[model samples]
Target: MNIQLNQKSDKPIYEQLKSEIIRLIMCKELREGESLLSMRALAKDLGISVITTKRAYKELEDLGYINSVPGKGTFVAKGNQTMIREQSLRRLELKIKESIELSRQLSIERSEYADIVEFLWEE
Candidate 1:
């Protein structure tokens, strides 16, 4: 419900909306069965077109993040723990890959990298 749209971002508005919704759902900020604003309402609130919000909602539905009920409204989908874990792991993998590349570029030893990771972990 607290989504921020960046017009200056290289990403499209719909994609930005979709990603923020997914992140909120994964983080449990949007709980299962929680209702979301209608496309028109959200669009008005965000000052975006209804089509853009609709597209983002459609993608979220397609990706199993939310479900739409015709007269009732859209609600968060249940059983997202596995999907959340997968998302978290994928993000961590990307970060680790970046760290490894940086380590190589700096000619850092494996042991030193391990030490740094350990120190960071305990912090």
Candidate 2:
């Protein structure tokens, strides 16, 4: 798994890490049941505190993207198809919302926006 952190970005370090990990999982780069590095190890690798990594893991666990097994380690959660679909849909919805806002700001016609969406969808 590859994650790049930007200390200069407005986003928090932990949030950036969490988002990259989620993206990896969604892209199947990190498969189900694959073990993740320990919080300390990840923090060291990213040059951040363990607390930041722990928070990211905790949030991922709460979202059902991963789970922790006692005495073992953290692994990607088993198939939660419904949850996964919901997450994917949420991301699509947010993108659509942003597109709508931008189109409105640019005074783009509805039909033109629809054509753009359809064109992208077909690609």
Candidate 3:
């Protein structure tokens, strides 16, 4: 699944896993109905705990990004674009809010912040 976890990251492993899976789905690398590895298998592959994989899978399922079938396996859910887009926007908004707070603390002007954003957007 091309999932990568950073042990040194401040984010939890399960959150990283969830984000990677979502990124793959958003990038069309994981199509609708595509089966995912079992939680145990993924934990072994990623060198993480089964509990971590379970938590990630549960969150993904709750978010409508994937589905679990008893005795079967997990598969990507269909028609989840809207949900995915909303989630992405929420994350971006949170990040922007943090940046705005930091800029205020540093006395950076709004125009300068906008310029930086524009430069990054064009990069």
Candidate 4:
């Protein structure tokens, strides 16, 4: 698993971690039934607190992305990839809405916004 945290971004570090993992899962980089690194392991690797990792993992579990066992480690949940893709796209749409609202507040020109959006899509 690879996560890059932007210290200057407004987004929380944990959320950055969470979103990257979800994207990986949706992209099949983290396949169904693949076991994730334990919370302790991830925290150590990321140099973040265990609490942050736990919170991200908890959210993933609540959203049905992963399953946790008391003795066993957390593993990716198996399901229809189409359904997961739909769910992920929905989340992206909602985030896009938020970004659009912010753009409006900042009085960003439609052309300028489109350019930025195009760059991100290309990336």
Candidate 5:
């Protein structure tokens, strides 16, 4: 719930909110079945519009990351491990691809690129 929005960034506010929530869930900061702030409350806290929080929450629910209960509130979904894992893998793959492209641009050897990866992994 310790979200810091980059108001200067080009990304949409709702997307930033959604991504932070997802990051919290992935890091186990927000555990399964944990209740989240209501849309209006979150909007007020973040100094954003209620519609922005609503859109982010709605998208998260559609993606099975959270669930909303009438009058009860919204809680993290309990069975999204597979989806979360897949999302993590996809992000890793994208980073790897970007590294590979950078290496190619710099004419770095494959072994050297891999060594950098290994070093970073250990750190």
Candidate 6:
């Protein structure tokens, strides 16, 4: 339950919170059925409103990352590797595409780009 909130980020606080939780789940830092700190507790810890944390948790549930019980608490949803892979690949593809576009904008030659990728690939 380690989440960092930045007041100046372009992304909304709830969205940032959602993304960080998802990353933690994908990295196996959060395990299935593991309980999360209560929304009120998290809000107090992060110095944010409880409603904001609720919205973020709601979205995480919507995304199938966690499950909420009526009077209990939120727990990590069971991992589905296929689902995780699809979600993860979508994020990664966008990042790689952005990098490629930036490289092209800088007028880097194709050969130089390929060589650089190859170097990183072996590392």
Ordered from best to worst TM-score, the candidate numbers read 4, 3, 2, 5, 6, 1
User: What's the true lDDT of residue 46 in model 6?
Assistant: 90
Task: Write out the backbone clash pairs for model 5.
Answer: none
Best by lDDT: 3
Tens-digit lDDT track of model 2 for 1-123: 699899999999989999999889988899999999999899998899999999999999988899999899999999875778698789789999999999999999999999998999898
Question: Which residue runs of candidate 5 sit more than 4 Å off their true CA positions?
Answer: 91-123
Q: Give the Å error, residue 28, model 3.
A: 0.7
Looking at candidate 1, the ten consecutive residues that score lowest on lDDT are: 79-88
Which of candidates 3 and 4 is the stronger one according to lDDT?
3
RMSD of 4: 2.1
lDDT of 5 at 16: 96
Top candidate when judged by TM-score against the true structure = 4
On residues 1-123, what C-alpha lDDT tens digit does candidate 3 reach at each position? 998889999999999999999999999999999999999999999999999999999999998899999999999998758877798889889999999999999999999999999999998
For each candidate in turn, the TM-score is 0.70, 0.74, 0.80, 0.83, 0.73, 0.72
Error of 3 at 105 (Å): 4.7
Candidate 4: regions farther than 4 A off = 101-109, 120-123
In angstroms, give how far residue 82 of model 2 lies from its true place.
Answer: 6.1
Q: Between candidates 2 and 4, which one is better according to lDDT?
A: 2
What do the candidate models score in CA lDDT, each in turn? 0.92, 0.92, 0.94, 0.90, 0.93, 0.87
Model 1's alpha-carbon lDDT is: 0.92
For residues 1-123, write the lDDT of model 1, one tens digit per residue.
899889999999999999899889877899999999999999999999999999999988987888999999999987757975686688789999999999999999999999999999998
10 residues in a row with least lDDT, candidate 5: 79-88
